[model samples]
Target: MSSTNRASSDDEFIVVREILSRLGDKWSVRVIHEAAGEPIRFTDLKRKIERSTPISSRVLTRTLKQLERDGLVTRRVYPVVPPRVEYRLTELGQQFLHHAQEIMGWTMEHQTAFETARREFEAQTTEQ
Candidate 1:
């Protein structure tokens, strides 16, 4: 193991934590994933995102706003009879998705290990 990994300064650690806290957010990462490729309308995104895990419309709106503020997503509005709005991933957001995809893949691959560990832990605790 690298010494730097173990010995990052307090300030550096906090910075890393903040970055992870944002990127690791439940809605943000999924929102970015859904926004990838083509621009998505709010209603479509809401439907698509909830196909697996349900997210509140309120939380989804808040997540999108946060992402826009962070420069990770772009919000485009159109003038029409009814206002049309779409969200797309910014360049930075695409780059983030590449990393996020890797992490997600790794987690999927290792999930069985996690389940096994949890079962073992529970067994040990029950015996104790």
Candidate 2:
């Protein structure tokens, strides 16, 4: 078996690497952003994102836990029928949103390039 790795100076790469390692996670940023508007029940969060397409429950739970562990999200549990859990963004999480929004804004500015690449990728796959 073969392995690949990336190497760079700690001072040169740590910050960007750390940011990507967290935000680059599949549902981390999305789940956090979804919780930004208000505190949302666990089920509500799952449903909201799944409206576009279903995400595995395991993945959603895992992402929420990571966000919470990183001090970027807050989770509240209620005692009642069937139990209730709510999630909201911590101040740090809101700060993270600023970075996310900047990336999104850049994507919007170059959306044409994204579309072109997607079409090219699709064309290459179909040809094979």
Clashing residue pairs in candidate 2 are none
Question: CA lDDT of each candidate?
Answer: 0.88, 0.85
Task: Name the candidate that leads on lDDT.
Answer: 1
Write one digit per residue (lDDT tens) for candidate 2, span 17-51.
Answer: 76677767778878877889789998899999998
**Cα lDDT for residue 42, candidate 2:** 88
TM-score of each: 0.76, 0.72
What's the residue-level lDDT of 102 in candidate 2?
Answer: 92
Which regions of candidate 2 fall more than 4 Å away from where they truly are? 1-16, 113-128
Task: State the lDDT of candidate 1 residue by residue for 27-70, as single tens digits.
Answer: 88888888899999999999999999999999999999988987
Query: Best by TM-score, which number?
Result: 1
TM-score of 1: 0.76
C-alpha lDDT (0 to 100) for residue 95 of candidate 1: 91
Worst window of 10 by summed lDDT in candidate 1 = 1-10
